[model samples]
Target: MRDTYIIGVGMTKFGRAGDWTLIDVLEYAAARALEDAGLGENVESVFVANMGAGILNRLSGLGSAMVDRLCLFPAAAETVENGPASGGSAVKIGAMAVGSGAVDTALVVGGEVMRAVTGWEATDFVATLTHPEAEYIYGVTLPALAGMFARLYMDKYGVTPEHLAMVAIKNHENAMKNPDAHIQQTVTMEGLLHRPEAVVNNPYVAEPLRMFDCCPVSDGAAAVVLCSREVAERSGKPLVRIAGFGQATDTHAVHEREDPTELAAVRTAAERAFAMAGRKPADVDVAELHDAFTILEIAQSEEAGFFERGTGHIALEKGETRPGGRLPINVSGGLKARGHPVGATGVAQVVEIARHLRGEAGERQIEKPRVGFTCNFGGFGNNVVCFVLEREG
Candidate 1:
């Protein structure tokens, strides 16, 4: 297979955009990515990632709508949906098309207008990601399931609530440097510990998972332009090669898994990716794991081999996962502080990594970065996608 490279990446600020429509956000980001690629009308194909714009905004046909808005009306357009991993799946398809020489250039976009509905309504909409007959009907929301997973992880791994809060504080501190991050507040451990009222002020969305621990419902979009190596070289932009890609799925029902704390799919996917990239976890200079909840960062770090089994929480305590530490994870504030616009998150992670590898991450930039990794988990780790990126000399 031919190699694929990301030539350009762009994203809208990930937060509540009270005035921007879904189309507006998509158009804005897509156009910027095209300009960044130095291509005006050469896109050969388009893949869009959006889970439920119809349910969220009563709008459908987002794929074709986006193509038309970009004035690439003649190009073939397809939509990909895989719960919250939808964006990563789209990027995977786009890269595969370029790798197979089926398309010289492809544009992958992930956009969502989730804030169109009220908070409770958005919660219900996201809960539909659960199995309908077996889970959703039983009133299982994402937060509720995540709470169970967090509780199990703590019980099995000796992770505490303070560890979880530390994850939040760290990411919030990182988000302060990210212009596109959703939450930019620099939270202090003292403030978190001393303010008892503030602890419960945000209130518990689900037991063991408070509001601050949960990612906010966000409205945003992100896009990337992928091309074959030959085409990328011609564009004259700094390139980050797609070194590895792997995806795996587990039983849709969370209860069916042998261990609630262990994300089998994440382990499988990361192993495949690391093998493909011919690199170990230590080789990764930076990473962006799916931190929809703070506990997920800890669970995923261990599952992805960034830390030894049951030692991820300790890694956090040692500051190994922070910037200027052993390995920086989620310098873009992550889903927790960066805002998780479900469908848009996976692609956004790629965009951030691409920036880091290209040395264009600005304040969040890592020193002498060579390799970056991203993990996108869907529906309580039932579906997981991992991408390994390397800087091209």
Candidate 2:
């Protein structure tokens, strides 16, 4: 297999695109990535990643639409959807295409226009990812799942509401430094947990989970240009190779698992990625964990082997997960603050890691990061994709 490199990355701000259609968002991000790669309509294939555009936005055939909109007339086009992990799955596909010599250059774009309907509508749309007869039929939303997982995880690990709040505070702080983050406002423990009006300011969404703990419903897009090593070298751009990737899946219903709190898929996927990259969690200079919920950051940290199981919350309290801290988990503000446009999220995580590796993360950048990693989780840990990226030394 050939080595695949992410030569360029681009994204639209993670917020409401009031008037832009989902395809419009894709076109914008795709154009920026293509231009960033210094390619003039040279893409050979296009992979569009999105979860709800078909039903939520009343749009489909996004890949062909993007290729035609960008005037890459003959480029092969395909659309990929794998629940919330859609973005990561698309990148994996594009990378594999380049890796197998099937495609020389590929553009992967992921976007979601969830705000097209009311908030409840969006929630229902995401709930469709659950088991049709077991979970979705009972109206189990994503936050509902996170709430239960948080309760079980906390009870077993001695984690508390304060620990979850710390995750929110840290990510909120990081979000402020990100120009494109959705929730740019800073969150204080007092406002979220201690204040007399805290209940009003941060209402409980699901039991033990407050408004601040969950990622906001957002609409945005992100894209990346992937090519073989030769194409990357020809682009005269900083080389951030897709060193390795792994994907895994668990039971469809969350309760079917032997251990509900253990994100087995996440752990297995990260291990596979690390083994392929010949690195360990400690070797990861920086990382982007899929933090659609605050507890997910803590949980995923452990699952990805960044911290021991049940000790992820301890790492959060000790500042090990904050920027400038030991590991610096979510410098792009994460899905919690960066916004989770489902399909756009996985691709966005990769784009964030690429920026840090390229030394273009501005104030949020890590100090000369050599190795970066991203974990894109889907369906309550039922599906997960992990990637290891290494800078050219």
Candidate 3:
């Protein structure tokens, strides 16, 4: 297989994309990526990643629409959907097209215009990812399930509300430096947990998981331009290779899993990615873990081998997960503050890592990061994708 490199990346501001159709947001991101690559109409394939355009926007045929909008005539076009992992899955498909020598370049774009629906409607749409008869029929939202998981995890590992709040505070602060982040405002521990008005200020979304602990329902888009080694060298951009990628899936029903607290899919996916890259967890300079919920960041960190089980919060307390810390995670503010647009999230994670590798992250940049990693969690951990990226000359 030929080597693949992500030579260009682009993202729209993550939040409510006012007056922009999903197609408009997607086109903007894809155009920026093409311009960033400076390859001008060399794209041979296009993949559009999205989850709710049909359900929420009453639209489909996104791939064809994007191609027509961009005027990339006759390029192979396809749409990919895999719950929230759609972006990652789409990237994998693009890499395959390049690596297998089928295409010299591929444009992969992911986007979601979730604000078109009401908050309750959006929440219900996401909840549809759960098992139909076993979970969804019973009205299980992601936060409700996360709350139960958080309670069990706290009982077993001594993780507290304070620790969860700490995650929020750190990510919120990081997002303040990211112009594209959705929640730029910072949060204080006192405001979230320690004060009398905390109850009103940070009300519970679900038991044990407050509003601050959850990622906002957002609308955004992100894109990446992937090319083979020869095309990459011609583009005159820093070579950020997709060294390795792995994906795994657990039982669709959360209750069917043997251990509720263990994110087995994350562990398996990360392990495969590291092994394929011929590297270990310790080699990762910066990482972007799916922080759709605050607890997910901690739990995924542990499962990804950055910290021991039940000790992720300890790492947080020691300031190890901050931008200049031992192993900075979520410098893009993660889904926590960067905003989780579902379809856009996985591609956005890759975009953040690539930007840092290229020395473009202004304020939250890690000093000369060499290897970056990303874990895009899907379906409440039922499906997960992990990627190991390395800078190459």
Candidate 4:
């Protein structure tokens, strides 16, 4: 296979995009990425990662629509949906295309416009990701399932609500520095502990998880330009090589899993990625974990080998996952503070790591970063994808 590199990455500020349509967000990010890559007129093909355009915007064929809007009329285009992991999956496919000589350069875009509908409608739409008969039929939303997982994790690992709060506080602080982040306000322990009984007060969204613990319903898009090593070299920009990638899946229903607390898919994917990169967890200088909820960060950090099982909370307590700590995790604020716009989130994680490896993250930049890793989980860890990125010399 030929080597693949990310030449450019761009993303819209994620949040409630009041009036913008899904196609609008896609076009915005696609144009910015093409410009960043100095390939405004040379895109060969396009892969779009969109999960719920039809449900959210009453539109399909988003890939073709994006290509049209970008004025790449003749470019081949298709949409890829793999639950919330759609973004990372699209990037993986684009990288594969470039690496396998199917396409020299590909534009991969991940977008979702969720705010076009009411929050209840969006919530119901997202519920389709669960097992229809056994899960969703039983009123299991993402937060409810995640809360169940969090409860299990807490029971087994001795994690506390305060530990989860620390994760939120850290990410919100990090988001303050990221212009593209959705929720930028810094929350103190006291602020979270004390709020108006109506809004900011901790009312349980799902048992044991407050509204703040849940990722916001967001509408945004992110795009990345992938090219073969030859194309990257010609662009005259620092290269972020796709050193390793791994994807895995498990039972769709959460109850079918033998252990709810153990994300076996994440462990397997991370192991494969680390092996391909010929690097252990210690070799990673930074990371971006799918923190759809705060507990997920801790669970995934342990599963990815960054911290020992049941000790992820200890790592958080010591600030090992914060910027300027042992290993900075989620300097993009992760899905929690960064805003998980479904399909956009996974690819957005890749964008952040690419920027970090290129030393282009500005305020969130890690010191002398060399290797970076990203993990994107879908459907309560039913599907997991991990990538290891390295600076190409």
Candidate 5:
């Protein structure tokens, strides 16, 4: 495969994009990325990632719409949907197009306008990712599933509510530094767990997973410009390449997995990515884990090989996962604070790491990060995509 590098990255602030249509948000991010790349309307291919446009927005043909909006006439355009992992899948396709000599320049944009519906409606929309017969028909939602997973993990790993609170507090602090993050307010352990009014302030969403633990429903978009080595070198941007990527899937139903607590897809995907990148967890400078729920941060940290199994929360207790620590996970505040615009998230993860590698991340930047990793979890870990990105000089 030919070498591929990201030339530009852009994203809208993750929050309520009150008046913007889904196409509007997607166009905004795409324009910014193209402008950042200085590519004009030279894109040869376009990949738009969206999960709920058909269901939530009553719209379809996103890729064609984006091409028309961007005026990239005749560019190969397609929409990719893989539940919440749609962005990662789109990026993967874009990279493959460039890497396989199919296209020199590819544009990938992912966005979702979920808040247009009521909160409950949005929840039901997202719950459609679960198994239709075994999970969805039984009224299973992502938060409910995460709560059960958290309960099981806590019992097995000795992770207490305090650890979960720690994840929320830390990510909230990180989000404060990210202008694009959805929730700008900071959270405190006492306010979330210990205070008398904690119950009212941060009520339970699903058992063992409180309001603070879950990412807010948000509307946003993120985009990246990928190109071959020659194009990247000529563009005069820092060379941040897609070093390697891996994808894996487990059973559709959570209970069908041999070990429900073990995110086998996450483990396998990360392993394949790291092997392809010729690096290990210790070599990673910064990382992003899908933190739809706070416990997921702890669980993914372990599964991604950042910490030993069942020891991620212990590492969190040691301040190892925070900024300035050994490894800064989710310095962009993760989904917990960054806002999970489903389709936008995976691309947003890449955008964050690329900015860090380019030394462009503002207050939340890591110190000279060389290698970065991202884990985009889909369908309760049944489908997963992992990417290993590196800075080349």
Candidate 6:
């Protein structure tokens, strides 16, 4: 197989994009990526990753519409949906296309405009991904599950609410440096925890998982352009190779897992990605984990081999995951503060790591990162996609 590389990346400001249509957000990000690559009419294919356009916007055929909007006439067009992992899944397919020599270049864009509906409606729409008979019918939502997980983990590992608040505080600080981040505000431990009225300041979404611990429901988009190495080299851009990728699945129902606290899918997926890249977890210079909830970042850190199985929260206490720390994570703010636009999140994670590798991350940039990793968790660890990206000088 031919090697694949990310030639360009772009994303729309993730927030309540008032007055912007779902297609508009997709086009905005896609055009930026295409323009970054100096690509135009000749693009070979376009894969749009989205989860709620049909349910929330009453729209479909996004792929075909995207091709027409961008004037990439006659290019193959399709939409990819794989729950919250939709974006990472789309990138995987695009890389496969380039690697297989079936396409010289592919445009992968992920977006969601969930704000059109009330937050209540959005929550119900996303819950559709849960097992219909086992999980959804009972009215269980993602936060409710995460809360249970957080409580169990805390009981087992001694992770305090302070630790959870630390994740939110740190990621929020990181988001301040990211112009496109959804919540670019600073959060302090005192404000979230120490104060007398912290409850009012940060209400509980699910016990043990407060409002600050949860990622905001956002409307946004992110895009990437993948091409073969030969094509990438011709563009005179620094190459960020898709070194390796891995994906795995677990039980669709959270309760069915043998050990709910163990993110088996994350562990297996990261191991596969690292093995394919011929690297170890210690070789990674930076990472982006799907921190849809504060606990996820800590759980994934352990499962991905960044920290010991039960010591992820301890590492967070030590400042190891900060920008200049041992292995800075979520420097692009992660989904915690960068916003989680479901389908767009996985793609956005890749975009952040790619920027880190390229040294274009500006204020949040880590120093000379040679290898970057990303994990896009889907469906409460039911499905996941992980990628190992390498920077070539």
Measured over all alpha carbons after superposition, the RMSD of each candidate to the real structure, in angstroms, is 1.2, 0.8, 0.8, 1.4, 0.8, 0.9
CA-lDDT, candidates in order: 0.89, 0.92, 0.94, 0.89, 0.94, 0.92
lDDT of 3 by residue, 1-393 (tens): 778999889989999988999999999999999999999565889999999999988999999999999999899999999989999889988988998999999999999999999999999999999999999999899998899889999889999999999999999999999999999999999999989999999999989999999999999999999998988898889999999988999999999988899999999999998988889999999999998889999999999999999999999999999998999999988899999999999999999999999999998889999999999999989889999999985
**Candidate 1 structure quality by residue, lDDT tens digits, 1-393:** 788999989999999878999889888888888889987456999988998887987777887888899888688898888889999999999989999999899999998889899998999998998989989998899999999988888988898878988999999999999999988888766566457776666567777877777888898999999998888888888879999998999998999988777899999999988898888889999999998888899989999999998999999999999999998999999999888888899999999999999999998899979999999998888889999999988
TM-score of each: 0.98, 0.99, 0.99, 0.97, 0.99, 0.98
Leading candidate by lDDT: 5
Regions of candidate 6 where Cα sits further than 4 Å from its true position: none
lDDT of 3 at 304: 97
Q: Can you write out model 5's per-residue Cα lDDT over 1-393, one digit (the tens) per residue?
A: 988999989999999989999999999999999999997457999999999999989999999999999899989999999999999999999999999999999999999999999999999999999999989998899999999999999999999999999998999899999999999888888899999999998899999999998999999999999999999999899999999998999999898888879999999999998998889989999999999999999999999999999999999999999999999999999999999999999999999999999999998889999999999999899889999999999
- Better model by lDDT: candidate 1 vs candidate 6: 6
Lowest summed lDDT over 10 consecutive residues: which window, candidate 1?
193-202
Clashes in each model (backbone N, CA, C under 3 Å)? 0, 0, 0, 0, 0, 0
lDDT of candidate 4 vs native?
A: 0.89
C-alpha lDDT of candidate 6 relative to the true structure: 0.92
Evaluated at residue 198, the lDDT of candidate 2 is 97
After superposition, which runs of candidate 1 have C-alpha atoms over 4 Å from their true positions?
none
C-alpha lDDT (0 to 100) for residue 318 of candidate 2:
90
The alpha-carbon deviation from the true structure for residue 19 of candidate 2, after best TM-score superposition, in angstroms, is 0.9
Better of 2 and 5 by lDDT: 5
